[model samples]
Structures are given as structure tokens and as C-alpha cells.
Target: MRLLRDLTNITFLELDVTSTKSIASAYRTVENQTGGKLHYLVNNSGAGFVMPLLDSDIEMGQHLFDVNVWGVVRVTQTFAPLLVRAKGTIVNNISTASCMGLPYQGMYCGSKAATRLMSETLALEMKPLGVAVVIVITGNIRTRYQGGSYFSSIAERIGVYARGEQGHPQMEANLYATKVVGDVLGGAEGTIWRGAQSTIVKFALAMIPTWLMNQLAVKGTGLDVMEI
Candidate 1:
């Protein structure tokens, strides 16, 4: 956030996505800033973890759902009035995980999948209200999210280096995000598969059977050798 604040032309408003009051406050701020008009609402806040479903702490996992699923709903609903007035677009940053049920990532994927579906429904509803809804079905690139749920070996490797391409860890992911917003402004709609390996994952899920896909997903996440 500090980095964003350092920029010259960007206006930043702080809010807690999990807190409805905070989102409402942010909405008020944005409304005041833009004079009761908004051009875009991007639901980008999310959280995730990796653990066996049997061993997972259901209570703790609720926080993940709150941040990933409820957060998007709260932010969008709170700012919807302004959005409708502007006839704007809503862009959601979803994950390729939403389309695949990989081992040990059920809760995270569930939250994303929920948001993906919710956005689809929202697009339909928002159409009459003159607002566009777009969802970006993203895939892994590189970031500083060192995930938990007892998978430190994998978590520790995150953001250590950019596996492919010649730039910083978040370069491609950030670029994709920027592109999505511009595309929306240019009349893009529905679900967009972006980021590294997103298209491959989407196409594979389309052609592959569920059982084989599950087996491959488990192997891809290193669950084949992972101890229970």
C-alpha cells in the first residue's frame, strides 16, 4: 500500500474486505472522490491454505472463506450503487484453482469457485442494471504469498525466483491484471483465462476426465509423495 501511495496519480483508499463497515466506509470515500460515480470495482482480495481435508481446522478455515468469498460480495454490494450509476464493470481476480480440485487445496479452490459462479450470476443480474461483470481465471505465476497449512516445503519456494520469463516475480501477474481492466473498458465480458498456464489448465480440464484429472492434480501438487 505504501508503494501505491508513492505513486503520483493513483488515489488509494484503505479498507478491510472482511469488515462490512470498512467496505462501506471505503465506498463512501470512493463515492466522495468520484462524486457518486464509479467506473470499476475490482474484487481482488483473497486468502488460501493447503491441508488435508480430514485434518483441517474447520473453524480456522472459516477465515479463508470470509476473506476470499464474502469479501468480494461485501465490497461489490457496498459499492454497487456507484457502479450502477456509472454503468461500470466489475472485475474479479479468480484462480485456475477454481477450475481444478487439487489435493490439499479444497477450501481455497472452493472459495474461488464460489466467487467465479457468483460473478457469473452477477453478470446476468447486473446486465439489466447496465453494469458489466468480468472474472479473470488466473493461473500461477509468481508472488510473495508463502502459503501455510503445514506445507512449508512448498510455501518456502514461493517468490524465491521467477520460474519463467525475464522479469520480477509479480511482473507478469500484475501486467495481466492491468490488461484485464483495460479490456473491460474496451467491452470485454464473462470469464477470461489469463496468467501463466491458465489456458493450458482450462483446456486440460475440459478434455480430461475427472478421475484422471484428480490423479494428475494430486501429482502436480506433490501430494503423491506427501505424507498424511
Candidate 2:
């Protein structure tokens, strides 16, 4: 991640996505640091929780929504005026799971789905004011947040164990993360290209009929369509 940062123009800022005050303060700091002119704002911060829906803790669901859905709403609302002032763009980094609907990651996916809709609605509302709202539906990306050990710990605690060829979700997540990290470290251009592809796919999917989209999502995630 550091290497990628060093190779790109991206700047990292520390902020608690779940906290409105923290987000506001961070925005203020960034504005002051950059002299109050923000051209492009990307709401990419998120966290995930994976567990069977019945066994999942309600508090965990709240936390996931806090960071994944409400956080984007809060950050975008805070920075929207600035973006509108600059006629800038706001990109919300959503997930393929938002539409695909994976098992165990229901909370995370639900939050992302909510955010995706919010972004679309905001895009329409902001268009009249010349503010561009873009939702980037991203696929799996390698990062510390996708660490295998972290997911394994959660799986173990939640009693969602898998044996033999049953398919360990944690292992799959780890592999996906590793591939994403490799892509990021390989070059900024490739990562951007992959992101573009994801956004295009998301846009195309959004244009499909709801029932068809639901069917495709069931096929994509290997989940029973009736279950969702």
C-alpha cells in the first residue's frame, strides 16, 4: 500500500468514517491543508462483517451500516457544498456484493447496496447544481482489511466453520485480497483500469430490469434467489 501511495498522487488521511465529528474535522483539516479548494472527493472508506444472518450480532450490523452506509452519507453531505462550489465530482466506492448478494457478508452488502442507491439519487439531485456524483462499484481488492487471519478469527467466533471442500469463505476472501493488493502494488494505472471496468459493469447492471438483475445476482453469488 505504501509503495502504491509513493507511486501515485493519492494522499492518505486518517478519519473515523463512522463519526460525523471526525469526518467534519478531517474535512476541515484537508481544506485547510489544501487551501479550501477541493476538486474531487472520493468516499472509499469502509469495513465489513461476515456471519450467518441468524447468528450475526445486531450491534455488528449497526457498526457495518455506520461505516458503510451512513458514513458515506455523512461525508458526502459534509463535502457536497464544497464539491458543488468547485463543480467537482463525488465518487462513492461501492462493492460488487451490493448487487451480487453474498452469503455471510449480508450486513456489509446490504449497507453497500443502500449507499449505491443513495449515490444514484444524489447524482440526480446534484446534477441540476452541476455536481457530479459517481458510484464506483469495486470488486475485491487486496488490503490489510482483507487479511485472512482477521476473517478466520471472525468465522471461528461466529461458529460458521467449514470443513473439507465445503469452501471456507475466509480463505476465499484472503486470496481475493492478495490478488487485489498485488494489482495495486503492480501499478496505479492497472488498478484504475480495473476500477473503471467495475464501474461500467455496475452501470450496465443498474440498467437491467429488477427481476433480471436479481436473477443475475443470484447466479453471480451462488445464492438462492428466493432466499434473499
For all predicted structures, in order, the TM-scores are 0.85, 0.65
Error in Å for residue 126 of model 1? 0.4
lDDT of 2 by residue, 150-225 (tens): 3343444333312222232232445644544454344321112133235555666668776776565445233442
TM-score computed on alpha carbons, candidate 2: 0.65
Please, what are the lDDT tens digits per residue for candidate 1 over residues 78-186? 8999999999989999998888786667888898999899999999999999999988988765665633455555533322221222232342646876767677777
Q: What lDDT would each prediction earn against the true structure?
A: 0.78, 0.65
lDDT of 2 at 139: 61
For model 1, the superposed segments whose C-alpha errors exceed 4 Å read 147-171, 220-222, 225-228
lDDT of 2 at 88: 73
lDDT of 2: 0.65
Candidate 2: worst-modelled 10 consecutive residues by lDDT: 187-196
